[model samples]
Target: MATYQIKLARSDTDAARHFTLELDSRMTVLDALFIIQREHDPSLSFRCSCRVGMCGTCAMRINWMPRLACQTRVETLNADAITIEPLAQLPVAKDLIVDLGPFFEKWKRVRPALHPKDKDSKQLAIVPPDSEFGRQAQVKRDCITCGACYSVCGITGSNSEYLGPAAINRAMLRLLDPRDGNVDDRLAVLNDETGVWRCHTQFNCVAACPKGINLTDSIMKMKRSLLFPKKFHDKQAAT
Candidate 1:
């Protein structure tokens, strides 16, 4: 049996808990955590649902990087000493669990759903599959709203109201959605205080996104289009 350590951090909790697990290298961080909680201490608490990478519930700060514990391998990390904590820039629910309320709230604030685009026509609202904007929207659909971007966002760390990259990305998706009845309406929401203005072009969220989505670039693109419409227009005019 191989021995591995997990360091736990929580909010308002006076002391940190160190858990030691003895198991094979193939065991994941989530596996080690489950065994430690069930066999070692039932009082301990954490959260997970899909053991697969689909559910975003298992995200935690593993070795200071926000990662899905289920997707991370124990053997791949430092076996002797590994720090496990709730995601940063979020309120801690307990050991290894961060509240997702604020994160998801911002997503809703962006109005991520598609709206009716057809006004008077009987024809279906159609967007060509190969359209450049359509492809960008398709990529944004892959976001799981895991709050990983929030954990590393400098804007999120500084401002409680700042909409993180995930929210911005969601808004971008909606803004690009041709079916939406009010593209300008969505832009109004994205132009608010907790909106696009808060981001400082920090690339941490981009680096931390496990899905490899270039979130920062997307956000900056929004900023440019929103803040300086003339710049974009002028460039278009030049062409």
Candidate 2:
């Protein structure tokens, strides 16, 4: 089996030092990390649940791309040397593990849950595939809340209060949800100076999104929704 080399941006209280590990080709970056932790460095720490990449916990910066380590193959990596580091725009608690408290806090602030117009929401007809919001939400709904977007987001780095793409995208999902109620409340939450206003229209969030969610467009939609509420009118009438 072909062998691969992995370099870690080692865990340090002050963010210094690095470690290296070499592994077999078939193993994934996450797999290699686990082996390294279990055998070589027992103190190494990181978060990973649902190794298939659905949990979003395995997300980390792998050679400049925000990817789920669990889903990335060691052999697939291009460079001879790979730099592994914790997600960006977050406080690194240890090697590869970041404090998720802040990320989730922002998520909650955006009201991630869907509140339908009526509690007795029936099996509504499908939204036309060509509709703007529907097409947009189709992409937005795929978000794993992995913090990948948050990691690469410069706006988040510059402004701690910014809701970030993941949160804004969540709000956009709610906006597209026909059954969703609480538009005013959702808008109010996003209207803060630190809310949608903080995005700065950077595409890093979209580039970093592992799920391919059009975060920039979603953010723009949310911003436009606030900028012009008339755009939110029913599609039938707009047509």
Question: How well does candidate 1 match the true structure, expressed as C-alpha RMSD?
Answer: 4.1
For residue 184, model 2's alpha carbon misses the true position, in angstroms, by 0.8
**Collision pairs in model 1:** none
Give the runs in model 1 whose Cα sits over 4 Å from its true position: 10-16, 119-126, 227-239
lDDT of each: 0.77, 0.77
**Considering summed lDDT, which 10 consecutive residues are worst modelled in model 1?**
230-239
Residue-level lDDT tens digits of model 1 in 1-239: 68877777755465448777787888788988888878877766788898887778888888988888898888888647888888987888777788899898888777777665555657675567786457886666678778899988988888888878998888776666555554665677778877888888879987878677889878888988896544333422332
lDDT of 2: 0.77
TM-score of 1: 0.86
For model 2, residues 141-200, the per-residue Cα lDDT tens digits are: 778878888889888888888788888888877766666665776677788888888877
